[model samples]
Target: MKQDDTTEGAAESTDAFGGLTPAEGLELLRVGELTVQGRLAAASNATLYCTVSDGLRSAACVYKPVAGERPLWDFPDGTLAGREVGAYAVSEALGWGTVPPTVHRDGPFGEGMVQLWVHGDETVDLVALARETDNEALRRMAVFDAVVNNSDRKIGHLLPTASGHLYGCDHGVSFAEEYKLRTVLWQWQGMPLTDDALTRLAALRARLADSADPLRQELDRHLTGPEVFAVRSRVDLLLRHRVHPYPSPDWPAVPWPPV
Candidate 1:
């Protein structure tokens, strides 16, 4: 990941809140001035710090261009941006709001995925939090990772804000047709899902059942037909089992540099 010099300019004068709500942020990303500030070093792929503004309001976001994506043996290149958007769509469809607002648009580096930059408490240790059984959000996220076939779920990817809301990011490798659910959240393994979790799973399964559903249509743009079918199959399997899945013995159970 290469860093670019910060673009010079002040935020537009519009909203009182220097930050934007998820809905507003999405619009801004669609038609706004995207200025690349720098590169995020923690990411393996090219992730840029960007500010999007429509001259009335401005929002801080991360931009990941498909052109800069590193080739992976299992996942196809140039699909990461679309996957990111698909993850956000799934999160919204479930009404979980676990993923920060994201959109696919043309950026400084061409078409890419732009997501609202979440400000979280760095003091919080996600690894330790993942171990605690009390965090229901983390548990839901784990289930979500399973449904999406997330290949990466590092501790650092879990962001907890001061308001106690948790958000997950870096979902470019998700929604694969294969069983690649590797993550640090295994504390709930073998445990039965809560009634609420089951309800949400049922809702997601129902939405995906309709070929013309908005969520399915949105995901169809990002994933292949078979890949989308796999997501529905995973949801069905989870509903049938109603228990947290155990790690697969054939593949590495957790991500590297878990934190």
Candidate 2:
């Protein structure tokens, strides 16, 4: 994977939110004209660089239309966009701002997922930072991945912003009912969860338990009932154990092209 450190063009990049908050970004994505800027060649599905504008405000974002999705034997077809939005909902519900603001809406290509693009700062070495097992943000990401059963949490997905915050993306393969938590961030394997982490997990468990939880309701739109149930189960299991999970011997612990 190529290392992206070019802050010089960030002013013109898609993530240039122009001081817009995440909530505002979501609204822009909903109402803005989604003009395709380019295609992201590395993704298996058709991922595009797009801009959304409402005549007054505009923002750069990534767009993944459901029609462009390739079939996966493991995951049901045409649901990748929903899973992406579901991941964002789960992230916000946990109060972990790990995912950039994302929404599922009608786009230039049809129904798809539009996300506020996150431009990572080239200054921070993400690989080096991942090795630091005690990094709070990474730790929370690990927990978030575990809850979502993220199957692709490669180093490239971990974006470090100029503000010193880390944001993760490419969650189309998450929320699997099966055990498929593949990621490169296993630095804290077997370590006990911090008090703060435990507190967050408890809070998340309670939220998921609510029958009318907005996040769960949103997730139901994209995920199968069993998949959503599995997410709650993972939270319960994590809260019960209170430790970082070890990799399974049956499956690959980390993604290929680790960076």
Candidate 3:
């Protein structure tokens, strides 16, 4: 992990995690002991801020216990934690670090989703960033949200790090069977897919087509059969259209409390 000079209102610097590699970070998160530090009172669910340690290594993380999830009418099949993990799987498979390193594990509360904490660059205006059309990372994230059918891509979920990397969180309501991509990132809507996006989607489509693909297997572990299938279907649709999806006329184009 690397540290940035600007850390005024940031949660914790990236270097606070002890310069762990992605594999090491994931391993620590998967096996380390969790100690609750405090609760994120702003979240709708029971989002706990904690430190995960395996004695030798440790990092700050957010823990969302399945037992603490608030039920939603639209997504009733699986636990929100599972959906969070599923969303991480999609992001990772695309080779996009849009979502932080997240895993499903047992914690003090119960089985839930645990993700590496990101300290966003507080200097960036999220509202302005969400509406930017020239950002490559944001464009990739928009495609990702479309694939996952993310229903809650609030401006607050955008985690623009001081290191210039962008990540998103609160994916508990994603992977719905219906087309419910309500996001503030519609800047690329109806535009031709970027060359990078086209290539990545093509690769993702092939991987999802294979049942033995690890990505598909991981998705199955969290999402239902239909939900997983819906993911593949969504990817196929994107590749077929070769363009950014338009906001659905039926569903609200953006989430409530956009920030």
Q: What TM-score, over all chains together, does every model reach?
A: 0.91, 0.91, 0.92
- Model 1 lDDT tens row, 1-259: 1111111111121221235656676777788889999999878899999888888888788999998899999888789999999999998877666788889998889999999888766778666787877677787789888888888998888876654667789999999887888999988989998887899899999999898999999999999999999999999999999999888888889988787
Write model 2 residue lDDT over 133-240, tens digit each, in one string: 656777888988999999999988988766556679999999998889899999888889878778878888787778698876898888998988899899888888
State candidate 3's TM-score: 0.92
Question: Which structure among the candidates has the greatest lDDT?
Answer: 3
Local accuracy by lDDT, each model: 0.82, 0.83, 0.84
**Poorly placed runs, candidate 1 (over 4 Å):** 1-18
Model 1, position 100: C-alpha lDDT score: 82
Clashing pairs in 3: 1-19
Clashes of 2: 0
When superposed on Cα atoms, how far off is each prediction in RMSD? Answer: 7.3, 4.8, 4.4
- Quantify how close model 1 is to the true structure by its C-alpha RMSD in Å: 7.3
What does candidate 3 score in Cα RMSD to the true structure?
A: 4.4
Residue 179: error of model 3 in Å? 0.3
Per candidate, the number of residue pairs that clash is 0, 0, 1
